[model samples]
Target chain A: MMRLRELAHARTGDKGDISSIAVIAYDPGDFAFLAEHVTSAAVAAHFGATVRGPVERYELPGLGALNFVLHGALGGGVTRSLALDAHGKSLSSCLLEMELPDPQAPPAAP
Target chain B: MKTVRIGSGAGYSGDRIEPAVELAEHGGISYLCFECLAERTIALAQQARLADPDAGYDPLLSARMQAVLPVSVPRGIRIITNMGAANPRAAAAETARIARRLGFGGLKIAAITGDDVLDIIAAAPWKLMERPDETTLALGDRIISANAYLGVEAIVQALAADADIVITGRVADPALFMAPLVHEFGWDMEDWDSLGRATVVGHLLECAGQITGGYFADPGYKDVADLARLGFPLAEVRADGSATITKVAGSGGAVSLRSCTEQLLYEVHDPARYYQPDVIADFSAVRLAGDGPDRVAISGGRGAARTGMLKVSIGYRDSFVGEGQISYAGAGALARARLGIEIVRERLLLTGVRTSELRCDVIGVDALHRGPGTGAMEPAEARIRVTGRTDSLAEAVRIGNEVETLYTNGPAGGGGASKSAREVIGVVSTLIPEAKVTPRVSYQVT
Candidate 1:
């Protein structure tokens, strides 16, 4: 299975304690597949301890983008967080490691 | 083809001013907008105001206006900005003073006020959106500033009154750009679609150089050229809610679909219902195409009627951050740094230093990603960083004292010790009814 980064790139934003990470595909054709596989549950699980709240994903088919809003992701945000990266700006790179169903390899073992 | 060219001069308060100067001189545009306020900035400005009456507004307001006004005036480019920070009237006066000093004495400036809801917020019951249990007014003694997110109506009114420059305090960031679109096109305020489209353009341009490739560089893979001289963005917005994003010639950075896409999703929570003071903009249907080099054409934004409520950014003195960092080098550096952190951790507890939260990290090792980040080849050096949150400055100082004490306390060749204890002012969000805030604009002559 290929890493999600092979098919897409992501950018992240923070509001208070929450961070919104938008994953945009390199090719518009791969968007449908990423959208289908990159579930909120999966992304939340991937981030694990870094993200402390529920995850909500919003789809933008026109732009082939998925916005995953991670609540309580900033470790109390910049004003309060003692974390080195208070804004969680690099969290998007960590998310790019998520594994997806490799198109070349016959899907996930059904 | 009724079109308006608007250029972003500054994004946040400390954004690069040289690019703004370049945009003012080179980018031919009717309106120049500077969005220079953040969530907790007003509180800090309020604190400054408490210390000095004439120093509440943005520190760079005069400098930016001085650089931009002369160029903008000759071109008849009207300036709109939220550089007012805590005090719009003061900021407008400051801008006017700068304009007069620059020999543009005929410039008319307007300040939109009434966003400050301290009196209302203090008396009325409002709950913090995050911690619903704690009432906003309950933190009365700790509260510093409370400003509502004003909309475009006040800005449109100011522009209609023939103000050459509009200075405001705590208006919605996107509204800084959207106001010109509404005033120039005379787009109906109730028309959600047009507002939505303009909002899209505003969002893209609000962060200044972000959409123009300042923040999109990834080295070899997603390379952006000449980022050091990155030019701010300018939008050629049409009457039909369509715009072309481009930058001035002889400037740095690029305007690509990737750059635009990264910015398009920046800080956006929901793609379908992006809420603002004026409208609920929908980016779901929005379309983007690469019109040419350094040019991306965008359209198809849909907007719905606005919510009756408006967001209020409340700033309060949260706590204090006490931090200390000391470095160690050579072969056994990692082990020494780890020991240093462990000592600071236990020392803080032993000293009975009041701490709300404590964090110990080895900077070159696990500080960022929680483990040996990007270091397959053993690090030659490492740093120990210990930070703690405390209620009082005295307690905060104690936390740093322990780290400084480590210098002689031993950790093997530890040097370059730095320590600081600073007050932390945090911002919280709350919603208030739109009727409570009556945004009114008044003008002053330079």
Candidate 2:
């Protein structure tokens, strides 16, 4: 339900190590909620890494959405760890899986 | 049921029946496309960046979002569009955002980008060959927007990703809708004939409802009924990418040879060979037959092997320009407007500044006697508009200032400066051969 931009941020490390971590919101409105509650510091805390620089936010008018770009990470060998050939891998899918949360538990019946 | 296609423009307005939309709703259409790029669009996108650096995607897609998504999705009608002028990624994101906001969160959106190669033009290894039409291959300098008109590959990829919406930038207009159908139907990628049929469908519908009646024969054309509820065409290709074109029923517009052929020549430079990123579709073999008042059938499309290269789009710094306008009233205004143009041109030349392009037209006054012909004018009033381009704003300003002189003792207005000058920028497009284009695919999910 959430726009891709609103739920994500991506940045590459000094050696071109790409690391992105975002909290996928289920509802479009919930993106605003995540943006409000999930601070960059919180994200850095979750990843156990130092906040490299100010998170650069993007309000994509053309796309009618928002996104942020964060830098630096605790470790840099995510791609190398895969050890899979680049042509055969779908990194975007892997990254997306990491960013999105499993379905939340249903609320108790009233 | 037979296949039908329709094409429209970028940033569609649901306020009326866009031809493409109309065809899809009323006529039994199978495909819908909208070609929204022009020389001015890149400039508009650039200026939009000035307003908001993240404004590369076309705003017009918003118009198509609410209207088409609900109906098309429910009906299993697939849609493809190139409303992603400068940034397909942003366009796709915006589309998904709108869908989610509207409670249609299940829709998956795919954005195709990285076709822009503005940075590497200086060192690209391609020959930068010239076309037979005397258009030179873009040098590192002359390039304004060098976006490769991608074929249907990315669209196919999006469909493989199970995306509900696919947005692309500067794709060959026909490929917008063709790629998705071919992919969804599991059409063999190597089946050139099937690809050609899909390409034909895309071409027919690329101009939206033009395959309907927006730009068709007069008198019989139902401008109001047709105009009020335009249709977006839809194709129902199966595993072979061959399908029928039909709308959801009870929409406006009629699909016929008159309408379809009119759209065929809209921006056509060559009828024999229509160029696109995937393959060269020969329009000569395309056959159209009027099945009914609201149905047009198409088939017999052929395509040559695709050249192995991606077209690249590169935009860079270009000269600035501005245009000024003034309206003259009373007798002799038409003649005066012409003289006014001459005076301005002469003055600018005398000052030793040359403009890249200049245009002059006497609108109302010229319309008076000749009924739209350029001839000896019998007065009334004149409105003069002059467009001049220069690298310097100073030179542009001088050209704008001379208009007031024509109005004073020269043409008609009360002298002194009568119009305002605007700073303009020149935009030119060139194609980069495929060898220089490299796909920059990045993946992420949120």
Which candidate ranks first by DockQ, i.e. highest? 1
Give one digit per residue, the lDDT tens place, for model 2 in B1-446.
32233333332323243544444455443334556664345545655655775687666678777676655665545556667777666777777777777777466666777566655555553443212243324344554555666777777776677665666666676777677566656666667767777777776665555555554423422232555565545554544444345443566666654355444433333344556677766555556565555666666677777766554433444454555567766666666678778887887788886787665555553221112123554656556766665777777676667765665545556232344444433333355666666543222232
- State the displacement of the C-alpha of residue B45, model 1, in Å, after optimal TM-score superposition: 0.4
Score residue A56 of candidate 1 by CA lDDT: 97
**Residues forming the 10-long window of minimal summed lDDT in candidate 1 chain B:** B369-378
Model 2 chain A poorest 10 in a row by lDDT:
A79-88
- Give per-residue CA lDDT, model 2, range A9-110, as digits (tens): 221211113233322332435455455545555444333323344443333221112233344321122211111111212221222223333224454579
Across B258-310, the per-residue lDDT of candidate 1 in tens digits comes to 88998998999988789999999998888899998899999999999999899
Best by TM-score: 1
Candidate 2, residue A41: the lDDT equals 51
Give candidate 1's root-mean-square deviation (CA, Å).
1.8
Give the CA lDDT, 0 to 100, for residue B35 in model 1: 94
